[model samples]
Target: MSDSRSGLFGFVLNGLGHMFRGGLLYWAWLALLLVLIVLGGWHYYLQLRDGLLVTNMSNQVSWGFYISNFTFLVGVAAAAVMLVVPAYIFNRKDIKDVVLMGDTMAIGAVAMAILFVVVDLGRPDRFWHLIPFIGRFNFPESMLAWDVIVLNGYLLLNFGISFYIVYNHYQGKEPNASRYFPWVLLAIFWAISIHTVTAFLYSANSARPYWHNALLAPRFIASAFASGPALMAIGLQIIRRVSDYPIRQSVIDHLALVAAIALQVTLFFVLAELFTDFYNEGEHAASARYLFFGLDGHTALTPWIWTAVLLLAVALLILMIHPLRTHPVYMNIAFVLTVVGVWIEKGMGLVIPAFVPTPIGEIYEYAPSATEIMVSLGIWAIGLLLFTLLAKAALPVQCSFLREKAHREVTHDDA
Candidate 1:
C-alpha cells in the first residue's frame, strides 16, 4: 500500500507539472481557463445559495441550457470513435497519426459533459443519491441512471486508454497493441451507446410527443456525426498549424466528407419530422408549431430554431459543392457552421421543444438567466482548457512515437 501510494503521488505530480509547463501561449491559455472557471464557480455558488430558483426553469420547462449543452457535448465525446474506426480497423495512416488527439478530445468532452449534468442537478451536494450501495439507483428503470452509468463508463474507458498509450510514448516506450486495441474496439460501441441511451431518455417520455419518434436516436447519431466531425476537423487543423506533428490532408478530406454526408442525413430527418408535424396538424404538432412559428404568442424559441435551420442549410451548401469542401477556408467555415447548427438543432432545439406547451396546456417559455449563462461559459472554459492542455501534452508524445516507429522500421530494413 505504501509503494502504491508513493507511485500514485509521483504520477499525479508528474502529470500536473507536464500540464502546466509551457511558455506564454500556455500561460495565456491557462489564464483564460482560470478566469472562466472562477466565473462559473461564482455562478454555481449563487445557485447553491438560492437553489434552482435562480435559473429560468419552471415546471413547464424543467430542462434548460445546461442540459442542452450536455447533450451536445456527449455527441462531441462520441465523435472520437470516427478516428478509431479508420485508424484501427481500416488502417488509415493519416488517421493513425492523430488518433491520440481524438482520445484526448474524448477525455475533455466527457469531462465537460459530466460537469454539465452535475450543474443541472441543482442540488449537487446530494450527488450521493445516485450511489448504488449507500443511495438509491434506478438502473434499468430510470433512463437517466443508464445515462449516468454509460457516460461515466465511456469517460473512464477513453481516459484509461489515452493515459496508458500517451504515458508510454512520453516515456519513450512503445505501447502494447494487444493491451489497448480490444478496449479501443469496445469504446467505439460504447460511444454509440452513450448517445443512443441519451436519446432513449427523451424518447421514453410519452408525454413529450416531440421526442417520442422512432427516428430520435438516428437523428441524434446523424447530427452527432455532423457536429462531432466538424469539431475534430477544426481541432486537427489547429494542431497541424501549431505543432511539428503531421496531420495529413487525407484525414481532413475524409472528415469533411463524413460530416457532409451526415449533415445531409440529419437534414432529411428534420424534413421528415417537419412533414409529420405539419401534415397531421394535431395536438402533437403544438411544440413543432411553437418552435417554427409562434404558438399562442410564444415566439421566444422561434428565432433560435430558424437561425439554426438557416445555419444548417448554409453548411450543407458549402459541403455539397466539391470546391468548397476542398478549400481550406471554405471547409473550415462549413465546419464551424455545422457545429453551431447541430448544437442548436440537437441540443437546445430538441430539449426546449419537448417541454413547451406542456401536457396540461402550459406555455411558459424558459430562457436561461444570466447566472446560468455565466455558469455555462465557465463550463465551456473548463472543457476548452482541458482539451488545450491534453492536446498540448499529446502532440509531443505522438510525434515522438511516430518518429520512433519510423526509426525502428528503417533500422529493420538496414539490418
Candidate 2:
C-alpha cells in the first residue's frame, strides 16, 4: 500500500516536471502570456482599488463586458458535451483519443467564466455568500446559486475525470471503463445543465423583454455547439503541428462537421428571433433594433453586430460546401471565423442589447472602458496559460503511455 501511494505521488511529480521542460518557442509563448497576465493583473488591481467606476458599466447597463464574457464562456465550458457525447456515448475511438483535450479546455473555460463573474462583483471577497451550505446561498430559489453549483461542479467533474484517465495512463494501464463511464455520462448532462441554467438566468428576467423569451436556452446551446467545437478544432490543429501526438485528420473532420451543423441551427435560431422581433415592431423589438441596426441614433453596437453576422454567414458558406469544408485551408478559415463570429454575437450582441433602451426607456451606450478590456485580456491570458501548462504535462502521459500500452497488447497477441 505504501509503495502504491509513493508510485502515485511520483507520477504527479513527473507530470509537474513536464510543465517546465519545453523548448525556446514554448518558453517564449509562456513568457508572452505571462506578460499579458501581468498587464491585466495590474489593471484589475486598479479596478478593485477605484471600484467598478473604472469600468464603463453604469445603472443604465448594469452588466457590461465582464458579464458578457462570463455568459459566453459558460457556453464554451458546456460545449465540451459536443465532444463528450460522440467520444464516449458513440464510442468513437479517434475522438476518444483526444477528448481529454476538450475536458482540459472546459477546465480553463470554467475557471475563466468564474473569474469574470468575480470581477463583475463589487465585493468579490463576499463570494462565499453564494456557497450553499456555508453562506447565505438562496439555492433552489436563486438562479445565481444554481450557476455557482453547476460551474464549480462542472469544473470538478472535468478535473476528476481527466486526473483519473491521465493517472491510469501514467501507470501504464487502461482505466477501468465501468468505474469512469458513469461519471462521463454525468459530466455530459452536467455540461448541458451549466449552459441551460445560464440561459434560464437571463430568460427569467421578465423585465428585460429582450431576454424573456423561450428560445434563449436553445439559442445558447446551438451557438455553444458551434463555438466550442470550433475552438477545439483550432487547438487540435495546433497540437498536431507542434507535438508528436497521433491526432488523426479524421478527428478534425468530425469536429468540422459538428460545428457546421451547429452553425446552421444557430443561424436558423437567429433568423427565427429576428422575424419574431421585427414582425410586431413593438417595445421588445427596440433591443433587437439596437443590436442589428441601432436604436434611435445610438449605433454603438451596430457595426459590431453586422461584422459578426458577415463573419458567421461566410463561415457557414465555407463549412457547408463539400470542397471548402474538406480543404484544410478553408476548413481552418471557417473554424476561425466561426469562433470570432460567435464571440461577438454571443458576447456583446446578446448581453448589451438586453439592457439597451432600458425598461424605463433610457438610452445609455455602454462600452468596455480600457480598464475593463485590460482586465478581460488578463483573465483570458490566465486561462490560456492554464491550458498550456495542463496540455504540456498531460499530452505525453496521454499519447506516449497509451501508445506504449497498445503496442504491448499487439506484440503479446502476435507472440
Candidate 3:
C-alpha cells in the first residue's frame, strides 16, 4: 500500500512537472489564456455587482451569450464519444493512440460548460438551491437539473477514465481491459444523454416555438458530432507536431470521414427545419424568417446565419474530396472552418433568432454587450487552459509508454 501511494504521488508529480516545461509557443499560449481568464473574471465581477444588467441580455431574450456557448460546448463534450466508442469497444489501435486526448477534451469542455451555467446565473450565491442535500433540486422533474446531473457524471467518467489509463501507462503497466471497458461503455451512452438533455432544456420551453421542436435535439447531436471531431482532428495534428507521439494517418483519415458525414447530417437537419418552418407558414416561422432573411425590418442575425451556412458548405466541399481529406494541410484548414461554421450556427445563429420576434411578439434585436463578449472569451480561455495543461501532462507519458510497449513486442517477436 505504501509503495502504491508513492507510485501514485510520483506519477502526478512527474506529469505536472513536464506540463510546465514547454517551449516559447507554449508559454505564449499560457500567457494568452491567463490574460483572457483575468479579463473575464473582471467582467464577471461587474456582473455580480451590477447584475445581468451589465450585459445586453434582457427580459425578452433572457439567454444570451452564455447559454449559447453552454449549448455548443455540451455538444463538443459529447463529441468525445466519436473517439471513445471506436477506440475502446472495437479496440482500434490507431484510434486508441489518441482516445485519451479526446476524453481529456471532454473533461475541459464539461468543466467550461458548467462554468458558463454558473456565470449566467444572476444570483450565483444561491447555487446551493440546485444541490440535492442543501436545497430543492428538482431532479428528474427539471430538465435543467437533469442537465446538471448528467454533465457532472459525464465529467467524472471522462476524468476517471483518462486518469486511470494514463496512471497505468505512467507505471509502465497495461491497464486491466476488463476494468476500463465498462466505464468506456458508460461514457458512450452518457455522451448521448448529455447533449439530448441539453436540447430538451430548450425544446421543452413551450413558449419558445423556435426551440420547441422534435428536430432540435437531433440537430444538436449532428452538429456536435461534426464540430467536436473536427476540433479533435485539428488537435491531433497539433499534438503530433509538438510531441514524439506518431498519430497514424489512418486515424486522421477516419476522423475526416466521420466529420464529413456528420456535417452532411447537420446540414440536412437545418434544411429539414427550414422546410418545416416556411412550408407551413405558422407563427413559429417568424423566428426562422428572422434568421435566414430579414423580417419586419429586423435583420440583425441574418448575415451571421448565412455566413455560417456558406462556411459549412465550403468545409463540406473540401472534406468530401478524397484527396483534400487526406492532405493534412487541406484537412486541417477544413477542420478549422467547420469548427467556426458550427460555432456560429449553434451559437449566435441558433439562439438569437429564436428569441427574436420573441414569444411576446417583441421584435427587439439581441446583441451581446462588450461585457458579455469578454466574459464569454474568458470562459473559453479557461477551457483551453484546462485542455492545454491536461494534454501537456498526459501526452508525453502516454506516448513514451506506447513506444516502450511496441519495442518490447518487437523484441519478443525476434526472440
For each candidate, what is the lDDT?
A: 0.89, 0.92, 0.90
Tens digits of per-residue lDDT, candidate 2, 1-415, equal: 1356438788778778999998898999999999999999999999889999999999999999999899889988998887889899898988889999999999999999999999999999888777767889887898988998999999999999999999888877789999999999999999999999999999999999999999999999999999999999999899888888889999999989999999999999999999999987899899999988887889999999999999999999999999999899999999999999999999999999999999999999988999999999999999999999999999988888767868898999999
Kindly list the per-residue Cα lDDT of model 3 for residues 1-415, writing each as its tens digit: 2366439888888888988999999999999999999999999999999889988988888888898898889999999988888887787988988898899899999999999999999889999898887899887899999999999999999999998999988878899989988888888999999999999998998888889999999999999999999999888888888888879878888889989999999999998988888887889898889888888988888888889998999899999998888887889888998999999999988787778887879888888899999999999999999999999999888878998999999999999
Candidate 1 displacement at residue 19 in angstroms:
2.0
Arranged by lDDT with the best first, the candidates are 2, 3, 1
Task: Note the residue pairs that clash in candidate 2.
Answer: none
Residue 249 accuracy (lDDT) in model 3: 79
In candidate 1, which residue ranges exceed 4 Å CA deviation? 1-15
Residue lDDT tens for model 1, 198-312: 9999999999899998999999999999999899999999878867888999999999999999999999999999999999799999999999997998899888999999998
User: Candidate 1: deviation at residue 142, Å?
Assistant: 0.4
Best by lDDT: 2
Between candidates 2 and 3, the lDDT winner: 2
Please count the clashing residue pairs in each candidate, in the order shown. 0, 0, 0
